[model samples]
Target: MSRTPHTKTPETAPAGGKAPDPARRSDRSRRAILDAALALVGEVGYNKLTIEAIAARAGVGKQTIYRWWPSKAAVLLDASLALAGDAPTADGRTGLPDTGDLAADLKQVLRATVDEFNDPAYDAPLRALTAAGATDPELAARFTERLLAPQLALYEDRLRSARAVGQLAEGADLRLMTEMLLGPLTYRWLLRTAPLSHAFADALVDAVVATA
Candidate 1:
């Protein structure tokens, strides 16, 4: 499958000022490389994927990729971030959809995430990546650091907001609560334990809110 180049840009500086910094332009090429990596991994499992393949697919030279990333796993980590469309802000925070209604906000984001997780375009590649990470310590660490931590932080932020507004009980363990919300869905999906449906999500929200 042909890959779509990632063109998502960071928030631009003031209009008509000096164009983006040279480093920022380099970042764009890095994003493109990542996009190619994810697409290739998704299309052809991780073991078969190579630095050369990613470079060719990304429209960059092998050295360009090697200059930024030491290995295919590193490229995949960046690709996962690019595919998620999340780049951390200057303050190290990645934004999550905040509609002020905690349940609504969480449910909306989770539903969209479920859709992405289930998409053929995303599922195969991620599954392959996960499998590779299971055996590769370095890749696993990068996966946790780059792909998983940011998402968990977003959930933690939302839970904190809910606590502030009294939607969640005082002294709630945001980490545990976040896990409670995610564990079941991931269990079902990763293990094929059962179907993941809207009903399951609604029930999850209800159960979690009641505990909060």
Candidate 2:
């Protein structure tokens, strides 16, 4: 079957978990590799995805992948980062979208997030990543460090701004507040407890602001 423009073959890291510098790779090839990795992992799960399969799908040499990443987990990590709009800075800070109105800024950010979670492109790969993280401690830690924590820090930055402007309750635990803002939505997504929708986003915003 011919691959769609969106479909690309996955890539795996080298035997020892070494990877190449992404900056040196062609942007098109890198995107192809990441796309392939995500699609393969989503379709076959991580264990069944091989470097050969990914290389074939990506139209790249296995050595190219081996030169860059040390393991399949590393490729998935990089792919997930690409899918999520790049990793936050090394300081664990990716500043939130700022529009002066805290509520609007947050609502806008969350809405975009809801859209990402709802996207099929994002959903399958994310699910695969979550599944792998469940059984692999090292992969899980890297996943948290590379993907989850930085995203959470974006929320932290927004909340801190709200606190600074007195939009939040004085002395509010920003960490807990950030959890309150995100935990329920994640709960719904992970557990299928309910539908995630714009209505849910509005409700979440209301609940969060009411407590602020």
Candidate 3:
């Protein structure tokens, strides 16, 4: 009898146990890293957030984080994007709520944003990022490019759709309109100067659409 040659497949387990799926393991680690980043940002503030702290919190090595991301800010940015539903879809569309009533849609989204800002879960981490970004140019650029710009683009898309339907002026400055509509909410939330509410959201929408 001839001795058989042993072949191991990718799915083959070791002698004593089942094979570990690298993809699933990576996904779990990614989720843990993001969750740890978010929780630590809220607890310690972005200024004090560190790779080591995040790694410990995530039960991962600091090198594991560095292998995936360049810095703590990058890690936090990924966490923020994962939490925020503003990322582009697989088709590369913003997927903003457009029910043909731009004003209603705008109000709806803004109101939800207001609620998020009011929730300590979201508010703390956001404040930490915002405050740190204000002082750190590199962080600020990354925050805007990765986190804020996508959201702003979503609003612009909605505004553009409204413009197409004559709900907005032909010469309507979509970018300016977007800023005008969202700028106040951001200011009030970041500055803690005033309460954010559905009514405030409605007012902002009304003000922007009034120019149509």
Alpha-carbon lDDT, every model: 0.76, 0.77, 0.83
Task: Tell me which of candidates 1 and 3 scores higher on lDDT.
Answer: 3
Error of 1 at 209 (Å): 1.5
Q: Model 2: how far is 8 from its true place, Å?
A: 29
Please, what are the lDDT tens digits per residue for candidate 1 over residues 1-212? 43755543343333345766656667667877887888888788899999999889878889988887888877787777766764322123446666788877777766766776677767777788988888988888889888787788888898898899888889799999889888887777777788777678778877887787
Clashes of 2: 13
Ranking by TM-score: 3, 2, 1
User: What TM-score does each of the candidates earn?
Assistant: 0.78, 0.82, 0.86
Candidate 3, residues 1-212, lDDT tens digits: the string is: 43655644333423434657755677789999998998899999987889999999999999989988998888999999887853222114455788998888888788878888888878888888888999989889988998788888888888888889888889998999889988999899998788888899899989888976
On the 0 to 100 scale, the lDDT of residue 173 in model 3 is 89
Which residue pairs clash within candidate 1?
A: none
How many clashing residue pairs appear in each of the predictions shown? 0, 13, 0
- The C-alpha RMSD in Å for every predicted model, in order, reads 8.3, 10.1, 5.6
Full ranking by lDDT: 3, 2, 1
lDDT winner between candidates 2 and 3: 3
